[model samples]
Target: LPSQVSDAYEKILSRSKDQSWTRIILQIILAATRPLTLDEANVALALAIRKNEPESHSKLKLELWLGKNFKSTVMNLCGLFVSVYDSKLSFIHQTAREFLTDSEPEGTWKGSFNMAQSHHPLLQSCIFYLSFPDIDVFHPPFDLIDDIDGRIKSYGSTEYPFLVYAAKNWPLHFVSQNAADANAFRIQARTLCSATGHQRDVWAPYYFEEYPNSTFDDWKVWPDLTLASYLGLYEAVEDILSKEKPNVNLATEIGRTPLASAITQGHESVVKLLLDNGANMKEQENDGRPPLSLAVWIGQEAVVEVLLKEGANIDAQDRYGWTALSLAARSGQEAAVELLLNNGADIEAKDRFGMTPLSLAACSGQEAVVKLLLKKGADIEAQDFEGQTPLSLAAGYGKWANLWTMLRGFVAIVKLLLEEGAAMETQDHSGQTPLSLATEKGHTAIIELLLNKGKESKLSLSQSISA
Candidate 1:
């Protein structure tokens, strides 16, 4: 099946009147994280050919080359190997991508397709597209346009259709291929980094436009190294480090170091490289979160191991006083929780709310973490500042609210807490018992369980009295 698919792909390429352009389009589609819209693909192709020109000139040249009927032309050129659905380009089948990317074709196409190598051209196109003149005008200080969304929509509609994709995805393409040794690639990367104004202008609008509710205030203080680290560009980090040692510990407005960026992004290699270059393992963010805590919360197990082996503080608390174990348990990061516990993390560490690992795990409906904490002898009757015990927390009491579907998790956790001799009559600061809390939340199963257990306890007590 794959051989036949590969053969068809080769024939499609072999028969192309413009083999280079067709291959570039196909490769762009193959490497794209999602299907590219017609506008995005058209702009991508334009950038591939006229990358050195201004954005306007590139569009003009593209229009001239492909004509107004470019959609049909592109489809006809790609032929049976590709398809267009709702104006988004993709391969005809999933196997086409798997076969082409997994290995080379059998005959004339042998040794031709390298999935990683194919990203090189797309990378070039994206960087060049980002580098176009006046591209940074959409960002702050220069962004005089009051109607930001309207302006962005208008610009994208009339000009630079691929700006958002290029701004956001350049790093993925940059890191996908081995462009480290290539001096041109290095220069291009550095040039983009050095153009801080241009960088923010292009990058921020794309981000804010996509996520309308997110704040961009703290984003202004991001240094080049921080951005590179956040983007997980390993080669860019190496290049920046080797050129001149920028402060590895230098933090952003939010106190996120390059190490923090790498850690949160799950870039283990970048994290290690930053660490070797004197990235502080103990450097806490503004919130007092250490590298280990960040790794644990983010569920970067390998990065968590890296930070631990390098001597990250196991019990360092953030401003909320939550330690790595506390975060892991709450987040249901069972592996990270186990790792921290094995490394001597305090099992009874309290957050600002005086919630223990068990309390948090139970409150968050983390069945696995709750079970693990129980096995590790977590305090079943541990009370928070609100006087809510683990059983009370598992009963869906206090600030925590369980969805109807998630109540099953609460039920299981309640069962575990009860099996461990958790006191059902323990009242929170609100004077609510576990059974009462369950009843308040309409958790009928948990209410019934508590009532049955109460009866069992009373029956055992009466029998002992009779004896």
Candidate 2:
């Protein structure tokens, strides 16, 4: 044994100096045994009784022996002394039993145990019980999943393994580990697609192959393309499309077509190739949403440009009567809104709710789009069906950045509205004035800007207050 062990033994022996030398030697020998068997425990108890040793001292010595040799000894003891011993000893025995019964060859086990002190009352535990110090039981290569019947089972199921206890959890582990393994990568990609209905793009790169003539219509070939596209494998997508005439128009069960998926994620190059290779630019999904709407909604300006160049209908509306320009404005895509407007999109187009694109731009605090629409001769005083103007909508959102952007040209528009006999005090059905809405939203700068432009209207109020 090391010096520390020898010193500890010497210290224990010194504490019992009043005892006979023979009894001390016997106690030390019993404590040094590799595993405390049942017979050994009996012998130890008998010796302590014969020597008239204190019960507490005898138990402490037994605990010290068990602490050092519990792994080897407890398994052989068949959970005998646990109920007879103190709570600490019982806990050690219980944990040892769990490890022996649940741990796999990989030395990691994922299962739950019932304990009085646990928060869940019944808590799941992943225990790494190992003899080698170099082995990390916490992060095993594969997690051992125990059956509902409490039997330890190998990872042979079609479902992916979950380290219900590992620090990095299962999904992240699967993602990181398989990210470089070709076969594992493909499996993970397919599994993710199946689980999430292939709506996400993270698995695209793993599914698509880097070869010509690889048609994704084949289930096997499709998995490859799905992985390639989801993983952002640009070269893989190009190579696959080059070799195989994959069905670029293939839509998932949820109606997420490959082009829509790529464009929504800002994969400009993949989108370009898909468009160039006859991917339907106007393919409306089951939801009646075209790919251009997704590009505009996600603020992918480059993808929007590519789609527009491919002659995608600039005025196509979704089921909600939302055009790409409406989506761009609502999502704060200034450039996309400009592109759509310049492409002859109707600036005053209203959605299903009768809210115009300008109203949406104003509500979202998109000052640039508001200015662009105004310059394009969009009616500044145009009201939604509820009689809410763009300025009123802008005041409601209280976006200072958007308010500032709008203010750069707002004076001229306010003047035009006033000259056009637009009601300066016009209220929505809520009876809220534009100034009241701006103040309620804390748009102090917008309130100031509006006050300066509406000084004539406020003059009578100012004179009344002075009187």
Candidate 3:
């Protein structure tokens, strides 16, 4: 039911070399987590060669994925063994897929296609491909997405295929178990790291976009021992730590220690290993954001519990004066907020901007954090550096903010503030009331609610005047 089983098809694939390439084509189809595009397959087969000499690379680039006869060559070699769908390599039928992966003959499948071992070849191909002298010039301006995409696309056709594929997939190949590929990958990683800022910038964007989820490891900006720990590379972490009198607290350029990176990655083993080997749990990174703060910043509760148990400074603030509770509350991390509150974090603690955790929680529309902080006696009318209260903060008045940005839960926070008897007529140093801020932000719901509260407060004031 798959392909027409013609004798001509059988005759062509029966050739010994054709059969070998056929096996590789099938393997590429079977083991791939995503579709293996025609161009990707062509590049893969080209690099399947094992030579590492500079002369070998020069020759390979000439015969790369864009080789003149590349299309017909792959077609003749594949025969009916594989199919092309949407320009991606694949088998024709479900039966073909099963036959390849079932291992019915028990280990007779193509040696090159074994999912466990195939990654090494891909990894080698990537490192070799990226090693091109030209890659040294492909630098994105910053870590921003548009800059990255634009810079990665700057390579010309011959270079673009290898450039995109290598940039996109190398991390998977790197993490694949065949990591000890003659120590080549380690040297490649070191080489990339050792390159000028321009070269490293080209590769780092892909790592950020795909590798691990968005975490604070900061591998894109700085791939250090800390990043290795975060990626759960035990050998790499141990290798870094085993050096003579290693500074266990060494932070990345972003101020993240190995422990902070591991925590962000949620690798408990790496976290424990760092701590057992002397990672300072209290060490803060980029903005005085301590390891404990980093834990809650990403909402890793397991790491949070560990840091708390290890005696992390519960109230430690970043350079902006944000504490663990402040970050969790702002990000709507209820579990972390609860954990910090239970551990005696200062619920009403103010940052340098005089914005308390409650203030941030309300502004971020995190109702639970707002409620939790209020339950813990957060100063409802506390003023920030802008002389704006938590209610004003809920109305979205940050010290550096010029515009009244509408936030979620504005109505809920407004109601809660009114219920708590927070002064409705209170104004910031700019003389704008909470109602004025809400009106400016065009938050009609919150504006209506606050107007009614204003009328009630006026009525109470008139009654007191008569009394």
Q: Best-fitting candidate, measured by TM-score? A: 1
CA lDDT for candidate 1: 0.77
State the C-alpha lDDT per candidate: 0.77, 0.51, 0.67
For 1-467, candidate 1 gives per-residue lDDT tens digits of 44666667677757767777777887788778789878778777766665364554354444543534667768667777788788788888886676565554465443456777777777777777777665546643335435566666667646666776777677788877765423447656765665354655665566546444433444556787887787777777888998878999998777889999899889998898999999988799888888888988888899999888888889998989999999999899998888889999999999999999999999888999999998998888889998999999888653334455155488788888888899989998999999888888877778878999999999999999999
lDDT of 2 by residue, 1-467 (tens): 23453344334433442334223223222222123333333333333334232243234334334433533343233223133233122323333334323333211111221121111100111011001122222211213211211221122111112111121121222222222332323333233433234322222221221221332223233444544554444545666678666787877665667787677667777787777888888788787888888888877888888888888888899999999988987766777877888898888889887788877876765666766776677777778877788777665554454455355444333434444444557798888877777777676665676776588668967999999
Off by over 4 Å in 3: 1-37, 46-55, 59-121, 127-161, 176-233, 243-246, 251-273, 298-310, 342-344, 372-388, 395-407, 419-444, 451-467
Compared with the true structure, model 1 gives a TM-score of: 0.84
lDDT score at residue 198, model 3, on the 0-100 scale: 48
At residue 270, what lDDT does model 2 achieve? 74
The candidate 3 region of ten consecutive residues with least summed lDDT is: 104-113
Please, what are the lDDT tens digits per residue for candidate 3 over residues 1-467? 22343333344446536566566555555545566667777776676555662343456667765643666677777656567777777666565555444443333342224565656666666767766655554544544644444555555234556567676666556666364663556645545543244445666555564433343125555445665665665555655667534677877666767687788877766687788898887677766778888888887889888878877899988888898899998999988888899999988788888888888887777877788778888888888888888787676443323233334556677788778888878889999888788767676667777888888878998999999
Question: Candidate 1: deviation at residue 424, Å?
Answer: 3.3
TM-scores for all candidates: the values are 0.84, 0.46, 0.64
Best by lDDT: 1
